[model samples]
Target: MPTYEFFCHRCSKPFEVTCSIAEYGRKIKAVKCTKCGSSKVVRRISAFQVQTAKKS
Candidate 1:
């Protein structure tokens, strides 16, 4: 699963969704503003920050 960032033009709010890449891509096209219920949504560059252990 990956985290995705979305910008809502209708409500001028930013929201995040975590799902599989395929799920994200499919649902993203139909995403709407939770506040305004508008289809004016844009996908922004989402970050997946993680800290990993170094190999010994």
Candidate 2:
């Protein structure tokens, strides 16, 4: 499973959920707002960091 970020349009809050890649590809259509219980949620582009080894 992978973590995905979501934004609730009703409460303007962001939340995360863990699901399979297939499920993620299917798209989230009925996700409820974790804070306000609203179904108007949209997927958000999450940022991640990549670390590299230092040069010798």
Candidate 3:
């Protein structure tokens, strides 16, 4: 599962949704704001961290 960040335009706050890629693609139309329970939410561009193999 991936954590997707979203911002609610109505509530002016941010929230996160955890789901699989397939689930998100299929249910992309069903995302709502957690604060105000509004469907007027937009996905936020968030940074993710990646761990690489350490050099010997």
Question: For each candidate, what is the lDDT?
Answer: 0.73, 0.73, 0.81
- Give every collision pair in model 2: none
**What residue runs in model 3 are displaced by over 4 Å at the alpha carbon?**
49-56
Q: Candidate 3 on 1-56: residue-level lDDT in tens? A: 87888899998999998889889886667999878899999988654432222332
For each candidate, give its TM-score against the true structure.
0.64, 0.63, 0.74
Q: Each prediction's Cα RMSD? A: 5.2, 5.7, 5.3
**Residue-by-residue lDDT tens digits, candidate 2, 1-56:** 67778899988889987778778655566667778888888887644411222322
Best TM-score goes to which candidate? 3
**Residue 48 lDDT in model 3?**
43
Model 3 pairs whose backbones collide: none
RMSD of 2: 5.7
Which window of ten consecutive residues has the lowest lDDT sum in model 2?
Answer: 47-56
Off by over 4 Å in 2: 25-27, 48-56
lDDT of 1 by residue, 1-56 (tens): 76677789888899876778768658878877777888888877733332222322
